[model samples]
Target chain A: MAIEIVQCGALITAALLMIIGLVALVYLDNVLKKIIGAAFIGDGVNLLIIALGYRVNGIPYIFLQNMDVNSFLGQASYPLPFALVLTSIVIGASTLAVMLALAVVLYKRNGTLSATALLNDKKLGEENNE
Target chain B: MDGTIFIPLMVVIPIICAVLVNLLHEHSGVTKIFGYIGAICLPIVPILAVYGNHFFGGYQPLANGGLTVALPEAANAIISGSFLELFHPAITYAFGPGQQVILFVLGLVAMCAVFISIAETKKTSGVYLYMLFMLSAALMAFVLTDDIFNLYVFFEIAALVQVGLILVSRVRGNYETGLKYMLLGEVGGSFMLLGIALILGLTGNVNISDIVMMIHTGLVNPTNPVLLFAAGMLIYGWLYATGLPPFNAIKSEIYSKGLPSGSMLLQSFSVIACISIGLVIIRIFGYLPTAQMAMLAVSVIAMILGICMAMVQDDYKRIIAYLAVGELGYIGVGLGLATPLSITAGLFQAVNELVVTSFLFIGFGLVLYKTRTSKISKLGGLVEYMPVAALLTVLAGFAMAGVPPFNVFQSKYLLCQAAIAAGIPELAVIMIILSIVTFLAFLKMAYAIFLRPKPDELEVSSASVPKTTMAVMIVFLIICLIIGLFPGLVVDKLGVLALTAFAL
Candidate 1:
């Protein structure tokens, strides 16, 4: 019952994180906040994945000497989610690195981090004649 | 031979090559030798792949498909004893009937572009590392898998590497362009992930073949919204990756900022990834009427927006960038038509566009070298100062305009047949109008930049055209000629496979 409760708590946490991310994406005026929302979504996804991988009362999946096959099959800790989480983390980190580098460049070029400001700059020369 | 091993190795080899090249890049002589070696060796696996398909029927080059080959008893025992959950336990390399041949040709040409870029750059930088790495990852992800999630992972990796390469060039204005690309591209990636998550939840599996089988087995709802969402995410991702209309802002910026040779590789990688994913999504999810409608909508937007935007661009590279985006739409529309002729025309155009762009961009790069500017207005009377460069540029320009005796012309003609056959003669008319617009734009640019009297600000370079530059141009030109003269050589090989795959 406690294990079930913990699983419920995880789901709730994941939902909360996701909702906050969506709201942030929808309402945030600042570009940096949107980025933070993006990160929040990534975090929420990771948490949800871990929650799905959760096995009640499941110990580490190490195969011990003389391990009983029946017991293992019945309640083996799920390792697939763990592996997936790790891969997703690596991918997320690389993406973050590239994003940060780009953000820095954008800031340098336009002197602002606001998307609207940047869009305006993109339209800089076109406004004169038309 | 083993799918489990070969699939990952395709991504790994180029990574290893990138590392080695980066280490040796400081040594000019060593870098040259290593680049040549890498270029020559890169195509062997693809060559072997073609032969492998013939010898071992239905064997995909990489082992991740649903079909599995049983491991030898001994090896199985060892793995079983070790309690190792092999990520890939037994090789289940499944290549859809004739995908191997089409993938092989695309892979060969992509590698060819990389070799040509390496030869042209003549400078030691991180660019080559990113170039080879991006190409390898793109092709590996493209050819080796029938899995949707794996495709997403590889696509993200390739996008990162290509963005890195675009930034590596110290050319003016690329930094801003690269950032815009990164922001917008990650949004696309996130959508793809969202789609994958929903699909996994709905289908209980991540493998595309498993999902396809499940659909056939009645275990999956063909009209599930989750499946529709997944298809939508992937198509959007491809659009952003390929630089189509809605996402054209970022792609145009990057192409306008990066060097021409680099842009050639970037363009090919983006287009191939788009077409591959676009085709796969159409194949796997075409059962859904909504999915087909959605794809048709994206194709229309991309086609209309691409050429219209191309008609208005002032910068030479931006014009090419818009056309590249537009051309991808044409390919997308062909894929959408889902006819044998259309699919073949799309694939044929893909290969031709890649080849034709190489010459035009290289010619423009050479012109940039001679004139030191990319703006059409600033470039004038190149005929007097650099006759050879101007002549080649004109030929490339004509090819882009779809003139006769060029590969693009043949491909475009087939695309027209495809449109008309699909009962979209209006689209055929639009295509012809766009071709005319492209011709007029190129003619204006050519006359303004190359044929007219020299602008005082345009400086002719004291140095002669590098042998390597000329060689790259000649090589691409010859490829265009070969494809143009005998379209069947490529079409005969790739057409049937594309038709079979897209036919469902």
Candidate 2:
């Protein structure tokens, strides 16, 4: 009973974190904060994946020469999701790095990080060209 | 060559060339040679290879290897042994006529785009060539991979390369657009990952074929709310990736800001991603009526909204971008119809859209190259100076608007027929109206830029049009005419893919 409650708690927490991150991503204006929001979303997803693989007092998914296949399969937690999350985290980090690089470039060119200011500048430039 | 050898080579050669080009960044001559070689070889290799199952890491399906379980008495008290054994999953890539057709179009476009980029630019940077190769390679992988996780990885790579393509173009407003696209892509990708996790939890496999089998065997419940949520999440990623409605705003901006060659590759990504991911969704969740309905509704919205938005754009690039997004809706409708013929038409539209859009981008690119502007309002009477370009542009434009005797028209006709046969005549009506609207929109731009008297501010004498550019445009126009005349040459292969998708 206790183990089931703990599993549910972890799942709920992961969902809440994801919701918060999404809110920040959609509502926030600052480029840097939006990037942070992206990271939060990645972390939230990572946590969710990890929670999916969790088992009560589960053993690590490893094999020993002497261990029987049945015992290993019964006791070990699922390892596929863990592997997937690890790759997901790496991809997320690379994406975050690229986003930050673009942000730096935007700041250098426009002298601002706010999306609204950038849009205004574009509008003004278009009008000038016309 | 063996299936394993050539299948991976189709993806790897471009990547290797990208690295080689980047290393030879200072040697323009050498990079040009390497670029040409890579571009020419990408399509040829795929065409030469025989289609079959190519398993990454050499693991076969569970049916090939029988299962066995062994349990020790000591550990039995703590846990049950029934769940311990699982099939070792391998990344399975099924190469068939469908992948071959898509890869062929991608390769041809990439080749032409790279050749055009090399000829047009004064100083060809290796990094630029690198991004082009990376983008094409990622797209090739996107269409070829059968593993869900592998698809996600390639999808991210394609996204980054898209940003790189924009950043390297040195266009104004590209940086902000790239950032916005990246942020949204990140959110969409995370949701897709969450969805994949749910599917994995339920099915215990990432191989798409295995998951399909599991679902078919009733191991995974199709009607589960959790599965429905997964479907929704995957659909969100699909919309963002393919530039469907709501995501179309930033997507059009990305296209407009890119170098025309880059835009060619970018639109290819959108088409291939739509086919690949859209098929995946239909494969996994076609059992649900809501899923199909959702796709149909979104597609109609994209068609209506894209044409309307396109009609109002002053920039030629933005106009093409929105129209391109609108064309994606036709493909979506075909997929959403879920009939074998409709799906075949959808895949056929994907191929046509790839070639036709690239042709249009290159045609308009000639204008940008000569005039140094994409704004339709600032230019006039280009036909007098560049008659060949104006002619080809009109042809490509007609193709896009689904005029008869063009590539898009046949596929759009099939789509209409499929929709009506599927008992949804309204979809056909809406599609016809949108195509007409698109035709008018393109006609207006055509008149404004190509036929009107030359404005004083626009200098026609200084415009230097390259022979190579004209040659590439003619080649694309010829290809379009061939396919438009004989779509059966490609549609037969696509029919097999459609049947396979429906069977699953």
Candidate 3:
């Protein structure tokens, strides 16, 4: 029962991470903070995907020479979602790197990391473009 | 010697060429040859390859044979006849008539974009060409892949390549725009992934065909709230990808920021993404009238917002940008209608818009090339400088506005019929009014640029338009005319795909 609660808790944490990340991305004034917020969203997604593949007291998803097939099938927990999450993590990290690189460039050009200062313009008004 | 080998070649050739071109950036002559070689192959491979499925890693689906052959005997005995036996373990790419035509059009546009970009510059940057090729490859994957997760990977690739294309443009404030787009895109991308995860968690398979099969077989409940939520999330990503509604303003900004060459490719990407992702949505959620209605409602909103926004813009680039974004709604309308005829019309519109919008971008590109300004207030009387180009530009504008004897006309006529047939005549009326508004907006920009007297202060470049640009425009116009004259040549083939996918 306790383990089941922990498993469910992981899902709740994943949802909370996503919500907090989105709020930071939208409400934060600093551009760097917004990027960090984006990163948090990615981390949240990765966690959610991981939660899907989690198995309580399950064996590794590998076949052993002496193992019983039925037991393996019942106890091996899903490995597909883990493989998926791994790829997502790599893609997420690379994309975050690119975003950070762009943030650095924008800061150098405008000398400010504030989203308002960096993206403000006549064409890019707060109403829509921003 | 399998003919389907060309299917993978279609994507592989460009990727290999991207690397080659990137490495050979210092060698102008060598890069140009590689660039042309890769561009020519884009359309050719799709045409030559026979329609079939390619299973990556030779992992054929075990669904037909049951788990009896694939899984261990004990495991097979355990799940015996359950849905677990029907899961597809392989990555599949199915190429058919619809894919062939769509990829062919995308390749044509990409080829032209590459040709013009290389010709317009005295010394073309290999890095720019590499980005172009990579973007095309990603889009081709999106169009061809049967797995939704594969779609997400290529979606990210196309998005990143688009940012690289914009940053290379050196336009004022491009970096800022690029950063803004990326931030928003991260949100969209994450949600899309979450949706895919939900589908995986529910269905235990990422292959679209397998999921559809499970739902049809009554193995998975189609009315699950989680599935509905997933559909909603996927549609949000589709909106971002295709530049519909809330994303339209930024999507148009992306166009305005890109040079005409890159914008041409970018718009084509949105059109193709609309067809590919929209097809996935309908295939998965077609049973839900609410999902269909949602697509219809959002499309109507996009149409009104796009033209309204275009009408207020003085910069010709932004005007065309918004117009391009707005026209995407028509495609959504066709997809949203979820009927055989409507899907065909929607797809036909996608093909037509791909050609006409690129034509306009390249046409107006000449004005920018010659006058160094895209603002209508400062620009006037371009017809005198390049009569042939201006004439072609005007015709392209007419084509975009659904004028008769043009490609968009046939598609729009069908769309109206679809709206009426689907018991939504009000949508037909709205579309007709929006068509008129689209024409007027284009007319405003056209009259100002080509017919109005040249501005006293505007300095036009004495340099003539490039032959390559003119040649590419003439080719696109020919294609538009061909399709406009005999819509059957394309529509008949596309109808098969619509019938198969929209049969639900």
Best by DockQ: 3
Quote the positional error of residue A114 for candidate 1 in Å: 3.8
lDDT of 3 at B125: 85
Best by lDDT: 3
- Tens digits of per-residue lDDT for model 3 on B151-200? 99888888898999999998777888888889888998999999999999
The TM-score of candidate 3 is: 0.97
Candidate 2 per-residue lDDT over residues B77-136, each given as its tens digit? 433333222333567777889889989888999999899889888888789999999988
Instruction: Kindly give the number of clashing pairs for every candidate.
Output: 3, 2, 0
Better of 2 and 3 by TM-score: 3
What lDDT does each candidate get? Answer: 0.68, 0.85, 0.88
Model 3 bad stretches (over 4 Å): A121-130, B63-71, B76-86
DockQ of each: 0.33, 0.48, 0.49
* Candidate 2 residue spans exceeding 4 A from truth: A1-6, A119-130, B65-88, B461-463
Q: Give the better candidate number (1 or 3) by DockQ.
A: 3
TM-score of each: 0.86, 0.94, 0.97
Which pairs clash in the backbone of model 2? A70-B70, A73-B84
Candidate closest to the true structure, highest TM-score = 3
lDDT of 1 by residue, B1-504 (tens): 554334344455666666777787777666666666655555555544422222123443232242256654453554453413212322233343245444554555555656656665657554465566566656655665666666777777777777777777676555555655666666677667666666666765665655565665567787776677677877777777777767875676666566675777677776677667777776677676566566666767876787777677667777777777777777777777777788888878877776777677778887777766667777788888778778888888888778888889998999999889888898889888888887887888889888988878768888788776787677777777888888887778667657645442
Q: How many angstroms is residue B419 displaced in model 3 relative to the true structure, after the best TM-score fit?
A: 0.7
